[model samples]
Target: MFSFRFSNGPAAALLTAAVLLTVPGCTGPGAGQAPATSGPASGGGSPAGTASPGPPGVFPVPAATLSIPQVVKDVEPSVVTITTQTGIGSGVIYRGDGSIVTDAHVVEDQQRQPFKSVRVQLADGTQTNASVIAIDDPTDVAVIKADRSNLPAARFSTATPEVGDLTVVIGTPLGLEDTVTSGIVSGLHRNMPPSREQPQGALDLIQTDAPISPGNSGGAVADATGAVIGLSEAYLPPSSGAVAIGFVTPSATVTNVADQLLKNGKASHAVLGLVPADLSPEIVQRFNLATTTGALVIQVSPAGPADTAGIRAGDIITSFAGQKITQVTDLLAALRKAQPGQQVDLTARRGTDTKTFTATLANTSNTG
Candidate 1:
């Protein structure tokens, strides 16, 4: 069995030695105590109504090369350390009114319940209380309103980061605040399938080698120009034979979800209303599938988008929109890029017959 763990807090006794991936946030009885482990686990501008100082990509990029020290100086003020009764994590100052952005899991208690209010520590060491505003579990993004204001909000980049772009991560890892690490964008559009350990299931993440660790969740992942491009989410532990492999939530998603949360106190996601699973060799042999690659429709929701489009359980999704669906993650990534109420074409195979259907995506609400 493949195992994944959340990179939260200092390394506690292994919840399960088999776990591989982890979200980097400290969660336990105390910030000093080792946090419990689990299996594998945006946006710029003045989000919606609240007007902040900086907008997305407002920072000026140096024409020649990026100065690491200068980048750190620009972004550190916008980064803050977040502590709850359970443990600590990191967050970014989202607006001048003290709206902070962080991973949903960061504010979740040991029981995975979100706290109504938590403690926030500014870069200058000023501590204040913050109330949970909204949380989008599917995307693992959350917004909290701090009791303080006149803060320097970090500039988020609207432009997609290239693979080789320089990346700097600033967060409180292992309860050490204001830690900074550097690396380059390793890849893009990386997807994580839904698992018991990480039900949220990330889509279209920015892969980086920025040494993300425990307590790094919700921290800033900035580009060469000091523009916030992503937030540290999870990392593959070195025991998994992985090195410098970490995943970040891209800025576009951060802003999109943050804006919705700020305006509506909820975020909407495009849902196809179907349960999908990866095809196994044994299942393929048993079913005599014509193609081995594709997401197997495990179950279809009645009256849901897939059901309405005539997609039934046992059909293998071969294509979504205009993209080939090699696996469930591909479909999820495609869905993430699509908007609710939008119509798209879907192709599937039943037995040896190929069929195509137009599906109107549905909306699902996630409120804090």
Candidate 2:
């Protein structure tokens, strides 16, 4: 297997363009996002006692404050309900020519959960048969292709969002056709292990406070102006003792994963073979460390490349290559951009001395 090199330029621009041209939809990350229309606003009806009838969602987006009716009318065409013989999910249109993306678990058998045939139901309730055009299970994403062209595509966002922003979630969740919910972004660079629900792998989930349901999988989670920023994957169950928490795969991750699917049906991520902990102020005070922030290597995997390079616990990783490591995800983003097996330089602080080391990469499940 070969290492991956996904430059975050060309395709990212295309995704941004698609989103800017699209209208407001729905969202649900973990916290801090635009508010959603409370309760499914029924149909293209005006809000209680409001004389003017707005678009389907009634959310103010872009140039004019688009009404609920306008949002529904503009974005509905691009929200496709994906269902297969094995499972069902959602997919937002990415191109005008019937190219859409959804969670790979809903379409691929990488986990041996067989999918016989896939079908996409448009917002108009028109169902078109589709096939697996591309898939990358490491990211739990897949792209579907159909014979139809000139279809409506959803909008995408380029800026990395801040926590505490309003979020809107739109999908046919749990088989619910065309349902939209609202919430706020709570956390950023959330690294969570997979559960019984999400089967691909650990994800750097964008945590939101939106209401996500079973059928909400693979839906578009966007911010103000109806531009997508993340893809809904899982939600904190009501019984989990959590308040309106939802999880999403960030747009940056989505763009990389989607391009791989469109190109070779898969994508790869670099692995450092160590679990990292962000050294917060409290930890700094306890350790009386030099810098207030840096990534502390907690455990090094015995079989990982980092372990082979003699990376050990108690090593405070301050930087990777030339990029400063303010957080683990920051390092993750940088590594994802680097090709596996490629040499990487790091600045580590052991006690009072700063050191540098070079490590070769490793690839697993077709990616590194």
Candidate 3:
């Protein structure tokens, strides 16, 4: 069985030596632990040869493709090592004024609470204290403001890379600073289900063959032009019989969440006001579901959008906003694309009846 584990450090105790499948958040060195089995959950850039200024705080993509060494020289300065009380991880400078973006788990204490401040080590080995600006746990994105200034912010590409595109990962793995790895984009739109270890719920991630070890979380994954396209998030360990399979949080999400947190001190998510679960054979047999596939509405939040739309716990969500919902990940992905307060059509099957209802999505906030 293949298991997913977050590549952060101070490796945790091994739960089992057998083939275990679980996705735990990466922390410091030796922090590896068995992950819990879960079901599926849920760009950048500019054109070449343009002299125009890109988006604010973003660097325009270079016209020419860069070599691996060139890419490293371009991006390494923007990557930093983040050390919290519990563990160490990596981060990318997000702005010239010392704003750094990293995985939320990187700055969190052992109890998973965000620290008010942590230490940051820049590429040149300049160590400084950084205050936690905010954290959105659901998305696993966090922002911190270092005491220093005039940092080299990485140019983040908004364009989505195609499968087989070149990727280079730079981070501090296992406390070894300045680690670099290279690979190709293995897949796109990969969904990872929420687990106890990663409560960020279902995540839509970019799949790559880049080697991501512990302490690589929040590190930069740059493209051929040296423009960062994603942040290292998780990886399948060697014990899982998987090689070179890793996951990343796309730059689009990192920027979006960071922007929201910077603007409002919290990140907003479209909420349907219900708990969705995958429909199993047992559930189908018990509920006599009309279809064997779809998200099972196991719980409905009171006064939430779904509840207001008259959705019940026994309903099976078959579609959302005109998209077919084959499973919980589908529903979550659809929700990710939606904005709060937007009215959309949702279809569900209750017993032998299929019903469609219009729901105004609600907004939920996550803060540090």
Candidate 4:
């Protein structure tokens, strides 16, 4: 995970909580009981590159005490090496057949360069040329089916994670093969920016300190049960380090959306028909912030929800259907609580006066 400056800080826990993942009590390390499995090669940097181990006292969450040699033996056959003829990444077997899950950006034409071919290298030393089965570009998740079925499958956790469980990341980073890293779940309920690299507005993600690298995308993050929890994504770089601070996509979201792609090659979502932005504390002061809370409205789409609701520019959102809006993330989170065609009661501030309006949510579609 990337590091944020801690000098003038929030709390020691907040720094640890960033790049956060939800960790369950018994699944993490040192809160007392010994770990049943111990996994290693943990810390920031590409699975192939190294700067230095985490500052002396920083220890890793216990990986399955199960030995790496054994893990490789049991899991490697299912853990295939991926190469795009020009790029590299890792994948996980999601079914008994040869179907694998990896980052969409890892397999398709990305902003960096278009991929020529994506080949999977099996553990038996057999290499097979593969084609994309489907991709969820919105979420940056992709699925590729091998030529055969009856393949070994990775395990997934059916249980929900707590706030402090140990999290393990397994991947082939920076072109390296079968690497592992560890860290605590920093925090949860996160949302990342939408961009060319990531189309799906960042959904629920498991924040972790586990070291992630270039090749780690689409790799697995499992709990102590050896059940998959999330898919490794990008690193959140600390303003200070050359190495990146990493993130992962939650497995639940992956499972929910992948099936749709395989079935129809696309998914549907809702669009607000507006661009949201942050309202700085300074701006809050100048505008008297209505109530010092809510997403700041910079622009309203013509004939869109805001305009239809009679909302205008410079209005700071104070509440959404009765829920307080502190930031853009808060508003987005609230959006999920509603459905298309439903009325969304919005409260905004224009100077010292407060007002509320109702805008009907719109249904939108996405294919990744």
Kindly provide the TM-score of model 3 when superposed on the true structure, using C-alpha atoms: 0.86
| Candidate 2, residue 47: lDDT | 17
Q: Model 3: per-residue lDDT, tens digit, 8-108?
A: 32122211110011234565553343322321110112332234579999887656888999999999999999887666789999988889999877877
How far is each candidate from the true structure, as Cα RMSD in Å? 6.5, 12.2, 6.8, 12.8
Measured against the true structure, the TM-scores of the candidates, in listed sequence, are 0.86, 0.64, 0.86, 0.70
**lDDT by candidate, in order shown:** 0.76, 0.60, 0.76, 0.57
Least accurate 10 contiguous residues by lDDT in model 2: 14-23
Per-residue CA lDDT of candidate 1, range 1-368, in tens? 23345644322111110111223343322445764343222134632111244667785443344589998999999999888876778899989999999988788764555799999999999999999998766777889999998989998876788889899999987678899999999999888775555433557788898887767888999887778897888887767767778889988889888989999998777778777777889998997888998888887777777889999999999999999998877787788788879999999999999999999887774110
The candidate with the higher lDDT, 2 or 3, is 3
- At residue 92, candidate 3 shows an lDDT of 96
lDDT for model 4 comes to 0.57
Better of 1 and 2 by TM-score: 1
How many pairs collide in each candidate, listed in order? Answer: 22, 46, 26, 30
TM-score between candidate 4 and the true structure: 0.70
- Candidate 1 local distance difference test against the native: 0.76
Which portions of model 2 show Cα errors greater than 4 Å?
Answer: 1-69, 109-116, 193-201, 273-304, 307-342, 346-356, 362-368
Where does candidate 4 stray beyond 4 Å?
1-75, 112-117, 193-201, 238-245, 281-292, 336-342, 366-368
- Model 3 alpha-carbon miss at residue 145, Å: 0.7
Please list the residue runs of candidate 3 whose C-alpha ends up more than 4 Å from where it truly belongs after superposition: 6-24, 30-62, 366-368
> What's model 2's lDDT at 319?
89
State the lDDT at 173 in candidate 1. 76
Model 1 deviation from native, Cα RMSD in Å: 6.5
